[model samples]
Target: MTFGEKLQKLRKEAGLSQEEFADQMGVSRQAVSKWERDSGYPETEKIIRMGRIFHVTLDYLLNEGEGQSEDLAEGKNEEKGMYVSRETADGFLAFRQRKSLRTGLAWGLISGGLCLSIWWTEPGMILYLVLMIVSVVLLFSVKLADNPYRRIEKEPLVFDEQVKADLNAAFSERKKTAYLLRLTGIVLIAAGILICPLITTWVPLVDDIIFAAGLAAAGVGIFLCIYMTGILRAYRLLMRQETE
Candidate 1:
């Protein structure tokens, strides 16, 4: 079918008049009419917007046969939380990698600065040990944060009941993970604070170590909380899309 035919079909399916569709697309009615008549094409960005608005692929709007294959594949993968194409997966992966790298660097700086501060005051071996533990936890967060879209893609979308339940379960699990990490950090901090005075009397080195460990734990905990919160928000958006 021609692009015009596809445009009309989608517009009708959406139960939108030309004026209404134009309003939704933020374009003039004449522009929508032109598109429906195949007199002109939308700009690249508008094409993407139209595809999303119509629940169709760009290829389909462009009259490319590949869109049918993609649509079929997308339908199958909807239940599996996968994308229709490798390009989509790769694009998401690249975005996640960039975000993860930035997060890792930021955490590294904070953790490094804390360790350096402690070391400067005194040569405390325990400070290094505590930083090491914190580093490990941050590493885990980095790994998990890198692919925040994984759960969204893997969720089943067949029945509304099942889909809603799965989304809720995933969101709750994410929240639980964040809470546990934060609780662990708080406990470590309290323990360190209580032990600091005792360690100071025993040896200066012990005091510094305890202080460094506490700071590291707190820093990592804060980072995890922020990271998980962002993921939860993203999941909400995905759920919205699924429902829409």
Candidate 2:
């Protein structure tokens, strides 16, 4: 394919119009049009910039013998599913991270409210109610409207071997950290629940304080577990999609 043809293909695949791409290249629309027509050639610097912009090698753009008719993003089709691209996979992971954080925070706030309500009675009850309401809002805020990869949730996905391998490698390290967090969270929850009974006898009339502190620890533990589990599951979900 000609440089013009390749340039046009890259720009379109990236969902950029002539004017938009021209702006990114710091050139006029007419200049971009001329380049796509093969009447004008960009300088070496611009060509290099183009390679970076399209996530392709210089050979793919400069050499005519390079992967002709086989574009970098060849739109790999699967038997009965959509081909999940690298861009899509990365975007999905980022989206899941944000979602998990919001979800974890919501659960944490609700759990923490239980301790708060016990600590101060009337005022605590009001704050607890406020927390509950805030938690609900946080949970509801995790919507798919802004997520570009929302379709991945419903569609069967296909992946290249390399992508799956990379994800697994990263997940190996991630899993260890996640497990550590999960363990620490479990310990905190257990300690919080045990604190009341263990300290009640020694600290007379301090039932409220003991229970409040215990519940607070439990809340933090719950948050850690929920957050870690969420991210852990999200990575697995991607791997499973590749497997199935």
TM-score of each: 0.42, 0.63
Best by lDDT: 2
Worst 10 residues of 2 by lDDT: 73-82
Q: List the residue pairs that clash in candidate 1.
A: 81-153, 81-154, 127-209
Best by TM-score: 2
Q: Write the per-residue lDDT of candidate 2 for residues 155-224, one digit (tens) a residue.
A: 5666657766788898998999999998998898889887554775565458778888888888898899
Positional deviation of 198 in candidate 2, in angstroms?
4.6
Q: What are the per-residue Cα lDDT tens digits for candidate 1 across 1-244?
A: 7777778877896566887567545578899899888898889977765665555656667754434867734533434322222223234334554564456445643654474576754555556556666666766776666343443355432223544566567667776775676566456545544553345546677767777766666555545544544555555554554532
C-alpha displacement of 184 in model 2, angstroms?
1.6
Residue 173, candidate 2: C-alpha displacement in angstroms: 0.9
Lowest lDDT 10-mer window, candidate 1?
81-90
